[model samples]
Target: MTEFDEILKLEIEARKKIEQAEKKAERIKQEGIKQAEEVLSQVQKEVEDYRKEKQIELEENIANLKQELETNFKLRVEKIRGVFEHNKERLKSIIYSVLGFN
Candidate 1:
């Protein structure tokens, strides 16, 4: 073959090799993107699960606090009632004397 024909054949082979390399690169890039998406999806799910767990824990804590506060309030009210009952007779006597009806 002439030098020109040999050069043309070499050029054609080079083009074919370049095309194959480009195809391989594109496949690798697509696989990388797919793997990254999967990782992102898994992370999102894990974050959601963690958030839900924290929320439930917070709710339980709030419920316990509310219950404790209610119990304390009831105890305070009972103490106030006891105090008033113990002083009710004295209060009545004082009122009667103040009105000049002693």
Candidate 2:
């Protein structure tokens, strides 16, 4: 073969090798991007799940606090009613005594 032909052949082979290396590098980069996306998706899902769980827990806590407040209010009302009834009875007795009915 001529020297020019040999050089041309070498140049062609080098170009093929360079193309192959570029294709390999592109494939590796795509795979890395795919893995990173998957990891991000998983993390996002986990964060959403955690947020939902915390919201549920907060709702439960709020419900329990409301129940406690309601119970305390009812107890306070009962005590007030008892005191009012007692005072009313005493006033009745005093009126009866003053009227000479007792």
Candidate 3:
């Protein structure tokens, strides 16, 4: 073959290799993008689940606190009742003694 024909054949082969390499690189880039999107989706789902769990825990804690407050109020009311009853008896005895009714 002439030198010109040989040169032309080599140029064609080089262009074919370059095209194949470009296609392979494009496929690798697409795959990387797909994997990154999947990871981001998983992380977002996990964050949402964590938020829901914490919200439930906070609600339960609030309910427990309200129950404790109600119990404390009831105990305080009973103590106040006892004190008032004792005061009434003491007042009655003092009045009887002062008026000579003892």
Candidate 4:
């Protein structure tokens, strides 16, 4: 064959290789995009699950704190009642002495 024909054949083969490379590159790019989307979807689902778990935890904590506060308030009220009961007799005796009723 002539050198020109050989060069032309090489050019054709090079172009086919380039086209194959381009197709392979495009396939790789599409696979990468698919994998990225899958990862993003998984991350989003995990984030939603985490958010729900945290919300439930926060609600439980709030409920526990409310119960603790209510218990503390009831205990304080009971103590106050006890103190009032203990002072009642002395207060009456003092009032009678002040008014000269004893």
* Top-scoring candidate (lDDT): 2
Superposed model 3: Cα runs more than 4 Å off? none
lDDT string for model 1 (1-102, tens) is 999999999999999999999999999999999999999999999999999999999999999999999999999999999999879978988999999889
- Report residue 33 deviation for candidate 3 (angstroms): 1.2
2 against 4, candidate with superior lDDT: 2
- Cα RMSD of all models vs. native, in order, equals 3.1, 1.7, 1.8, 2.0
Model 2 lDDT tens row, 1-102: 999999999999999999999999999999999999999999999999999999999999999999999999999999999999999999999999999999
Q: Candidate 4 overall Cα lDDT vs. reference?
A: 0.98
lDDT of 3 at 37: 100
User: Of models 3 and 4, which has the larger lDDT?
Assistant: 4
Query: In order, how many clashes per candidate?
Result: 0, 0, 0, 0
Residue 44, model 3: Cα distance from true site in angstroms? 0.9
Comparing 1 and 2 by lDDT, which wins? 2
* lDDT of each residue in 3-102, candidate 3, tens digit only: 9999999999999999999999999999999999999999999999999999999999999999999999999999999999899899999999999999
Instruction: Write model 4 residue lDDT over 22-70, tens digit each, in one string.
Output: 9999999999999999999999999999999999999999999999999
How do all the candidates rank in terms of lDDT, highest first? 2, 4, 1, 3
Candidates' lDDT values, in order? 0.98, 1.00, 0.98, 0.98
After superposing candidate 1 on the true structure, give the runs of residues whose Cα lies further than 4 Å from its correct spot: 89-102
Candidate 1 C-alpha error for residue 3, in Å? 1.3
